[model samples]
Target: MNTFEKAAHFALTAHEGQIRKANPIPFILHPMEVAQIVSTMTHSQEVMAAAVLHDVVEDTSVTLEEVRETFGDRVAWLVEKETENKRHNLPAADTWQIRKEESLLDLKNCDDKDVQILWMADKLSNLRSFFRSRLRDGDRMWELFNQKDPEKQKWYYSKILELCDQLQDTTAYREYKILLKAIFSTDAINLQYQTGAFHFEV
Candidate 1:
């Protein structure tokens, strides 16, 4: 198997029986989409591999050392960077904002273009999923997240958008902008999801 195939298999196995919180779909699809998005940026096997394995250590029983041993040091490091820092023994509800804020700060100060591209790919894929789901379910979609407040979610995404804007030249970053603008419009006050009428340009 190629590097990406190997990583994909590992991620699929790690996430087996898991489903998307918003919808009852296989969790492996998220990593596959992430890998595809990163592929649009570069053909680097390590980046694609890392994208596929990004959530494994964060969301599954898989350990970072296992990823490092299986994928190598570089891919493992990229996965670590993509993984959210959840504090040990702390409730996610209590630390959600703090963890997100830390991620934003890390991205802001980050200088590595490859890492930036990988990060953009991940966010863009997530935004694409949100756009599709919102089109189908409207505001009720917010019920799926740990943080259910639409305003708070919008704030977090906006901050991430600004950090991503620095890499605006890339296609993935441009798509990220489009998704944000389409979903977080002023009409949000109407309690109606308007983006459904318009196709996601991403």
Candidate 2:
């Protein structure tokens, strides 16, 4: 099989029956969409492959060494850097600032543009989740977001900016940065981007 076929099969089998944290949507949708997003870029096969397998090492029983053996060292390394040990993920009450810092540090030391693409794609999934949550719970979530009582929305929204700041890709980051600005400026705009109602600025 070709690399793409191998990667797809690997991810599908690895993530079988899994779902997103707050949604019933299959978890594979994220990686699949992210890979699709990077397909708009050149020389991006590994970025696409890495996106499909991005969570395998971190969120699954899979290991980096095994991925290396399967997909080769480069793809394995991207997964390694992108996978954060949950000793790193914060509780909702804890500020996402710490998680943001870790990602920044990781981005700073990272030499691979491939990892950066994976990081941006990961945040794209995150922003998409915000829209999904808002839809499920309604503007009451927005009211709570404005009140900052529960702190979940604050953490999630700040992440959009933090991840945007960490992105070093001039072109893709610019595109996503525009999306972030639009998302923050108006709820209508946020929903527009989230629902594919708006086109990404070329």
Candidate 3:
């Protein structure tokens, strides 16, 4: 099997029992969708492999070292960049914003453009899922997330868009922005980019 096939198998095994909160689908579908999104941007087997393995470290018992041993350093590094640093000693409520902020910083400071593209694909797939869920369940969809505040969700996602602004020309980036606008209404971030008149707050 090629690297991507191996990564896909790894991810499916890692996420065997998990299901998406917004839908009853297997959680492995998220990584598969992310890989699909990344495939649209590049044909690199490593990038696509990393996309498939992105959530294994964060959501499963899998460790970065295992990823390195299984997939090599490049795939491990991409997965590392994609994984959030969840300060385990702290309560999730207390660490949520900090983790997200740090993630944005990593994206903004990333020297590898492919890393950013991989990250963008992940976000696009997530936002697309959220948008579809909202359409089906309306305001009830927000209840599925740990962070229930709509404004905070908007703030977090919008900041990611700002951080990934360098990729604005990509189809994933544009689709992410459009989904954000539809889900959150025309917020300051949307207006700022649309007419260059407003500044985003939070």
Highest TM-score, which number? 1
Q: Comparing candidate 1 with candidate 2, which one achieves the higher TM-score?
A: 1
- TM-score versus the correct structure, for each prediction: 0.90, 0.72, 0.87
Which lDDT tens digits does candidate 1 get at residues 1-202?
9999999999999999999877678999988999898888889999999999999999999999999999899999899888888886998878989999888888888877767877888878778888777777887888888888878888988887777655777777777887787776545422345433354334
Please give the ranking of all candidate structures by lDDT, highest first, separated by commas: 3, 1, 2
Full ranking by TM-score: 1, 3, 2
Top-lDDT structure, candidate number: 3
TM-score quality measure for candidate 3? 0.87
lDDT for each residue of candidate 3 in 65-179, tens digit (9 for 90 to 100): 9999999999999999999988788877778778888888888788787788788888888898886676566677878777788888899888878877667888888888877
List the global CA lDDT of all models: 0.82, 0.67, 0.85
Model 2 misplaced regions, further than 4 Å = 88-97, 139-175, 185-202
Give a tens-digit lDDT track for model 2, residues 79-158.
Answer: 88787655535553364445556766777676565666677777766666655565455444444332344354444545
Clashing pairs in 2: none
| Candidate 1 wrongly placed segments (more than 4 Å) | 186-196, 199-202
> RMSD to native for every prediction?
2.6, 5.2, 5.9
Output the better candidate (2/3) by TM-score: 3
Model 1 is weakest, by summed lDDT over 10 consecutive residues, at: 188-197
